[model samples]
Target: MTTSIEPGPSRYSFDNDDPESVGRHSHLSNILDPFTFQRLGTLGDLAGKRCLEVGAGGGSVARWFAEQAGPTGDVLATDLNVRHIPLDAGFRVLRHDLVAEPVPDGPWDVIHARLVLLHIPQREAVLARLAESLAPGGALVIEEWATEFGNLCLAAPDDEAAGLIDEYRDTLVNRVLPGRGNDPAWAARVHATMLANGLVGVDTAIDAASWPGGSPGALLIAVNVAQLHDDFIAAGFTEERIQRLYAAVQDPRLVVRSHFTYSTIGRRPGGS
Candidate 1:
């Protein structure tokens, strides 16, 4: 599929090449895989299905689905940052943009994207495109963050830390990032969005995490700070505050509950 409208640039790009961020995403996928599989399991055997994994960072879920699909089914894993997903059996990866280009022509039996659409300014249009790509009765599962306010609250070991996080989230994170076109609220509206696009049986499950000191989420918080330090500085956050937050994040005693995410599922209306 070829068309040139320019996918353009995202407000923020994941530094996939960075060792810290790469390691963070790898563990991130492991931590979040179960909730996704819970929904996937309900879809029954993928032995003969056609599946698409969009923005398939790390590609763990796509690899699993390809295994389940066995010899009969096929799976395509895609991301703009194309990394080689493990398990080549019945698996393929593509460097594709969900917004600008068409999905592979064959209608999909299941389409899944986690944390993908929220980053897109053209999310609604892409959602429409996803619906169009589905085979009759295909399921689409979208997992995304519901609110960063909950994530913000995790910074509090005390009132002082809480205040710092509140300042950081409100001033630096939310206002600065959204200007580039990421919607942290889109997860909460998945059911409504899917229904409006003529999908049926739309359901949502919200999941939040409590991270221990050595856990993946803890690392992600630190990695995020490293990635966005410039943005924070530009947003007028003090160098001192950034340093404090960075130090606080490394505390071995730290524990925090992250914001919730919705693993929302909807199916195209049609028959087997």
Candidate 2:
């Protein structure tokens, strides 16, 4: 799920308030959270740490942080629409607009955002702000998708299904998403940007896997259909074509490459 925490149609393409967003977050969490947790685990035990989770969609990662922080620590999960975040999870939730409002007062031990900053035109500025908010020696972890490698369809129900996947992929990468201000190229730049923002020991890793139909990866495509069918219709894709794409992703015979996820980690200087 792309966590566009700024509300309104003018700010983002996907709406967290939409019912489909729950599935979107779940499918994405299934596919991505393990890797995310692995990276964060390198920071050592988070007991008594103050953590901030920006653009928390379904709050899976925030809940993890809360569990790690325990009763004495603090975890703040913020999004423009916070309806999906659990209230009893020992963390606080806020109706935050990442693009418009100031960052919460955080000299935080850890700050994390996944599938978020690339959607904001002010991403570079936001990166700097996040770096500055970190407590000395605190870590920042950001994850984003890089789709430039193109979808490789290994198998499909038929030639039409294969072609539909390509067409839909192109339309999403080149048209609809960019029109909503998504920068597909930004993931590749996060490492250097973090370095320039005065963070030390910046590192990044990329993860991708085959997305066979009916798997969580393919479920992501189906969830996208529910979230963006209207956008496809507006982009001159027929209703049948949109639905066919959905069906193709659900067919076990179809296989495609998953989007490459760039996970970048950096730390503020001067802390052990």
Candidate 3:
């Protein structure tokens, strides 16, 4: 089958090349890996299955997949930038663009992408392609951040600090992310999209936990703020305001509920 996948007008908002991104990915892995791994575990034993991990930041989950799939299994990890994914790991690594490049040949048993598709403007199309690439009885697991409930500031030292957190989220989620072609609300639509694409037994599980200041979740917020500092400024956030927001997120007194993580999984039909 041939495809006419074209590059989108904008690329990912975060850059893996930045030195700070190492810490960012680490923080994300620490915060999200447990849930991601648990979701993958639901597929039962993957001893000989072929797995693909897309947009594999820091390669933590890919490494986990390698362990689960074992020596007889095949695991491939791919991303637009693979600087952080080590070649020495027990899996194959590919630096491939999801937009302008052809997807690798696959009748894969499992394909997983975390916090990836929401950043692509042509996500629905890419999703269709991914679904088509699945092997019979294969699973596609997508984990995305949804802003439906917003990033709630549950506790703060004061009302002013709380307001700053809200303002920062407004700028980041509404202005900055969209400016980079991200769809902040895409998570809610994944289920319907999967169903429309003829995937079976689609399920969406939502999870969120409170993040206190100085925790991995809060640190992720700080890392993102630093990485997107310029974009935040371009979004009309003053330097002083940005600084305050950063400090607020680390105040220890501040507690927040991060955006909902929607883990949507589906299976292809007809396999034993």
Candidate 4:
């Protein structure tokens, strides 16, 4: 038998030689802090456990987890684009796509996917696969963004540009991205999904905060918005409008807050 498969979007590629791909920028740490370390701490000790970090971008979080797991434990960090994973003695990196390929066999003590589900359209199916990989009494931790248009404020020089920025962001987040609007309810949905997939003891914890001023969180927001200017212009926004929006993002008065939610620790039944 023969099969034909259409190519997916080129979101992840091996060409991670860009300087931005390797840096230890505080901006990323700030944006990921609420979901990553803070929530992971709630999962208790990880030493001597087998852990898997899906979508381990740049392997930063995986590296941190490796430290927590220590020499007695093992960590496997996998990404669609594994080229960005730096050499590490404690962890193994593999290139895997949850949607198209089978997840590696795991009776893992913990399976983690942070800020990753939103990018995959078949989230429920992926959740089922993750559940199958969990060991008895193992945990699955997930974190995703909740982006609402009215919830975000722009600090542009004028109202018109600010509105355009909001529109562009909304369109990209809702239409271009794989998931629906990043709502807080997404946590509940994910928790329910895991429960339906036969996981036991499903629960969620939500964290919300604003990125203000020149903080790293604010800077990450600025950088992502700036990078999307061209896409906004291509989507019918004028160059003048794009520049105006950029300026607005730099305004000190504008506060951009994202609702971050984590649905963590869906344990497998029976502790098999």
lDDT of 2 by residue, 104-221 (tens): 9989999999999988889999999999999999999999998666756878989999998888888787878888888988999999999999999999989888888989888788
Where's the lowest-lDDT run of ten residues in candidate 3?
1-10
lDDT of 1 by residue, 145-238 (tens): 7655644555446676656656756764476668767787888888899999999999888887777545776667666667767777788888
Candidate 3 local lDDT, 86-184, one digit each (tens): 777789888788988877789999999999999999899999999999999999999999974564899989998888888878888888888788988
Q: Which stretches of candidate 2 lie over 4 Å from their true place?
A: 1-10
lDDT of 4 by residue, 66-115 (tens): 88998888888877666666555468777778778888777888899876
What lDDT score goes with residue 148 in model 2?
62
Candidate 3 residue-pair clash tally: 0
Query: What lDDT does the true structure give each of the candidates?
Result: 0.75, 0.86, 0.86, 0.66
Count steric clashes of candidate 4: 3
Candidate 1: TM-score?
0.88
Candidate 4 regions exceeding 4 Å error are: 1-26, 154-165, 178-187, 225-230
Q: Name the lDDT of candidate 4.
A: 0.66
TM-score of each model, in listed order: 0.88, 0.94, 0.94, 0.81
